[model samples]
Structure formats: C-alpha cells, structure tokens
Target: MVTYFEATLAQLSVHRVGNKGLNEFYSLSDNTLRIEDETLRRLLMQYFLSPFEKAYEVFRFTHSSDDLNLNELFHFSSMIFDDQSAFHNLSGQITKHLFNISNHPKIKSGELYIATFRDIQLEGELVDAIGIFKSETKESYLKVNPEEGGFALSYEEDAINITKLDKGCLIFNSEKEEGYKVIVIDQTNRTDAAYWKDEFLQLKIRNDSFNKTNITLGVCKDFITNKIDEDFEISKADKIDLLNKSMKYFKEKGSFNLDEFSEEVIGNPKAIESFKNFSREYNEEFDAGLDQPFDISGAAVKKQAKVFKSILKLDKNFHIYIHGNKDLIEKGFDEDKSMNFYKVYFKEEQ
Candidate 1:
C-alpha cells in the first residue's frame, strides 16, 4: 500500500558532488526520475531536460546554504512526520502554504499562487481553520495554511497569510511599525514566484524588467534582476560544440548505469531506446531552428520532454490495484463508474 511518492522517496538518497548535490532518486510525485552509480547528478539534469542555462540555478536551490542537500532536508523532515515525507519546507511560511496545496482540485501546470489569512488562530477547538478560498466555479470554502507564516490574506482588518506552494520558494515576513509589516512577492516573470490575492487573481512579473537589463557582469544580480538574462545566453561556435560533446556524458557514463537507473526509469528497453532515438532526432531538429553559433531551446522541446516524462514508466508490470480481484469486473476498467473486482485466468498443468 505504498504511494508512488512514498516509494520513490525511499529509493532516493542524498548524494553530494563537491559543493552541490543532486536528488539521486525518482520523484514520482511531480515527475519520473532516475539516478544511480553514474555522475548521477549530471545524468538527471540531462534526463530531466533541465536546461544548461538554468542548471546551476536549479542546482543551487538543492544545496544552497549548507551541506543539507534537498534530499537530506526531505530525509530529515520525513522522520519527524512519522515517515510521511511529502514536501520540503521552503521556510515556515512556505511549509504552511504547501500544506494547503496537498489537497486541491486542479493546480494547472503553469498556474501557481500565494495567499494569506490574517488574524487566523487555531486553538484546536475550531472544526475548521480560518480563511476562505472561493474559486469562480465553486463556492468559497474555509481552509488552513499548510505550514505556517507568510501573508496569506488581508482581512477587513489584521494579519497577512500565504498558502500553497508550487516549487522551492521562500515566503517573506517582515516586521512593520504599528503592528506588522507588509507581505508581497513579485512574480511577473517566470523567475519570480506567484501568490494568490484574496483568491481574486495573482500578479505576473514582467520579463522585460527582470531580464535583458539586469546582468551580473560586475556583481551578482540574484535571480530577480537577472531573470531574463538567465533565460537566454549567447555562445560562440566552440562552446556549442563543447555542449554537444558534453551531452555524451549523460549518454556515455550513463551507460554503465544503463542496466539499472535508465532501465528502471524507462521500464522497457524498447521505451528507453525510443527515448534516446527521439532525443537525438529532436536534438537535430531543435538545433536546426537555431541561428549562428548561439542557440536556445524553444517551448516545443520542453513540451516533448514533458510528454516523454508522462509515458515513461519504471515498472512494466505495475498495476493500480483499486479493489483488485474482489469481484469479476465484466469487460473491465472505466474510471467514471465503479463496477466490480478483477479476476486472473490461468492454465492447468497437463
């Protein structure tokens, strides 16, 4: 009765590489993943289609401050929660936000938000937590912050609170003069995180401002000022050749692990072959569209990668056992209606 996330987490262990560390396991929760014996940290980056430009940035998010890589953080927190390690705490505030998201109808692929609930207190007496979330289609319902902290809401009067998390992000809580300070995050561009405002609409950060203009030529501009800059880069012919050559690292050293990591992640060798074949074919097509020595990946490439991620499976024989074999389901499986259990047929020995 192990959930995919639980099973996947059990397989992953924190493996460090000098300064940064990569998650050496499959993240069945968000997406499929694999890492074993090879320079696994590097292998996953390519396998997951984590772009080279954002590589270091994403890498840092895993092992930024100290030795506790992302996996270690999960391993540590999982122990605290009776072995239910579902989320990594972004901060006290971010953790609360994640809690709210643990239950949802549909959080669109690109859709993300941060919200707050002011003057909300839980004395353990209330049947439900304070705060209301009203989606346009459905009536508003009372909810609680998953973790703790952040401005999730602006009551007619006090407190700001945020709930729900999409990725690894920090929620800020600054102190004000009178009682408390203001709470807001700029997410106009993709680099910035998004937050829900009174359940109305979230703001988007403008790419123009975050990108082109800000460069860390002299000093580091952080992710905000350099958002656009991070998204694009200009490379000469030699570097392009190096990248194409470097990619072999994933495919080459990746082979020793072929029998294990890649095999498990892809499930069937045929599927793995298909993925590799397509990667090469599409890589050529993608490169064909680029200009001169400089090149960038278009949305098309990332889209295909997502498609591959979904269909890729680690267990060929894996089955989703609902009420398995409890009853004989006639003509089998339909998600809409629940019928009966399934039965397996076998041949008698002659």
Candidate 2:
C-alpha cells in the first residue's frame, strides 16, 4: 500500500535510452529538471505512484554472485540515497546501465525518468523513496481551441498518458542493508527477456506472509481445478464445493496448516494424499517456498479470491453458480429430449 497525497517530487532527471541491438544511442540530461508548476508535479506524482497502490508483493535487489556492489543499479541507487547532490550524475550512470542491457531488439527506446520523492506514506510511515520510470509507448491527442471566433484543431504526437505508467519502480529507503523494500510495475515488454525487473533491477520476491499465502492459494486452486480430475471421478458441482470450502477455511483461519487444511477441505484419505503429492510437485516445479503453519495474509486472500470461480457453464443456454452444499445439486439426463440437465434444489427463488 503506497500513498503519495502529501509527497513532493524533490528531484527529477530525464534521459533517453535507445535499443543497443538496433545501434541506437542514449542521451543524458546535464542537470535535474526544475519543475516549478505545482499542477505538473501533482500529475507526475499520480502517474508514477498510483499504479503501486495494489502492488502487494514486495521485492529486493539481488545478484547472482551474492554481492550487492556488483549490481550496478543497486550501487547507483545507494549512492543517490546517500547523497542527494549526486542524483543527476548517478541518474546518468543508471541510464548508461540500462542502455547497456537494452540489447534485445524487442525492447523499446524511451525517456527514462529518475525521480526522488519525499513524505510518501507506506505502511503508516512517511518515508522518502526513489522512483525510476520509462515511457515506451505514446498516444496522439487532438487539441481544439477558439481562434478568433472560430475553432481551430491541432494534434500532438508522442504524448505520454499520465494514467498509464509503462514501467516504474519505487525503492523505499527503510531497508538499506536488506536491499530497500521495492515495488515495481512493468506494463511493457512482459514477454521479452524481463530486462526491466530481472536484468536492470535484479529483484527477487521477498519471502513473507503475502508470498506464502499467495503461493499456497495458487497451488490449492491448481490442484482443485486441474489436477484432481485425473485421479477421481468428480463433477463440476463437487469441484465448486471444494473451492468454496478452501475459500471458507482461508477466510475463517488466521494461519495455514497443510495437514489441517487437507483434513478439513479434502476429507478423503486418498484425495488428501493426492493433494500432498501435487503440492510437492507444484512447490518444486515453481520454486515456491511454501512454509507450513505460516500466517495467512488477508490481502492475498482477497486478491486471489477473484480467480476462484464458482460458475458452471452449461452448453449455450444456462450457467449455474454453485457456492454452497454440493448435495443440493443433482445431475440428470432426459432421454426424451436427448439432453442433460441439473436439478437444483433450493428453499426459495431469489
């Protein structure tokens, strides 16, 4: 949760980074941008910070060699954090580093903005943060104004939309030794080599309650939706019931215990054993460090609950939403009409 209602853009340095594989060049700004307009500063703040409001998973900068000094971005950002006077020079070095790594042809060349913020509210504390943003795409806007009793229209090309931030990251200055708490957004080049996050920032997901809860919910959904059907004869309603039960357990309990969840949600011994096997495979395949008997994150549950769909689609005609007891729903076949149907039992029609 990041809030910037009272934040001030202390310094900004803009630079142009081009694709290295295409033989393009990068240009650096000589000095920090002096933004005198309050309106523009507010809009810039909104553009850079709003996308992080829903970003729950935190990350920290990492290096393969396990040395922070080898990570150029981390070293440069540390320098900037240590001495504000070196911001512009360090931003130039950051731009050069990005240019060196932008060798992939698919990477777009855009203006890179290195900004420093003050008084940002993060988890109830007002901390200063460093922001790095790049604008890869632009939109065309038409402008119409009155010209001597007549309306004249003009168009501007290559305009950055303030609402859509292409790529950005906020580095809060709280955790210095552990590679300051970071949150990132990458709306462009997702399928490419992950140059923004992996190559440039070299970030690794922080191991915390949010990640644990998120990974556990993901594995549970995968097992219930995809894996269980292979071993057992289960109907759509039964699957929905299982999903509902899983959601109920997470919502009711403050922490997660693997054995307890399996016993409660998946009662059958065979099914519980199958679920454990699948969980192990999932954890190994994705390197999800799922800790047993860890606290569950309510925020993670709220975010993941959206994908636990309960809708059962039938042919082109009807859809059934199963949220409760599976016993109430009965599957039947009509020989006369040569069709199948579900007989739903309910107390009253809503």
TM-scores vs. true structure, each candidate: 0.18, 0.94
Return the TM-score for candidate 2, rounded to 2 decimals: 0.94
Query: What digit string (tens of lDDT, one per residue) describes model 1 on residues 1-350?
Result: 00111111112222111101121211113321234555754332222121112211101112233332233322233233333232222122233333343322232222122122122211111111111121111123444444465435422322121232123221112111111111122223232223233111221111121111111110111211232133334222222222222222223331223234335433445544544444345336533211111211232223222322112111465353222221222224557775433343435644
The clash count for each model shown is: 32, 0
Point out the worst 10-residue segment of candidate 1 by lDDT. Answer: 1-10
Lowest summed lDDT window (length 10), candidate 2? 283-292
Tell me, by TM-score, which candidate is best: 2
- Cα lDDT of all candidates, in order? 0.25, 0.90
- lDDT per residue (tens digit) for residues 126-232 in model 2: 99999999998899999999999899999999999999999999999988788788999998646794989999999988878898898899889999999999999
- Estimate the Cα RMSD of every predicted model relative to the unseen true structure: 24.4, 1.8
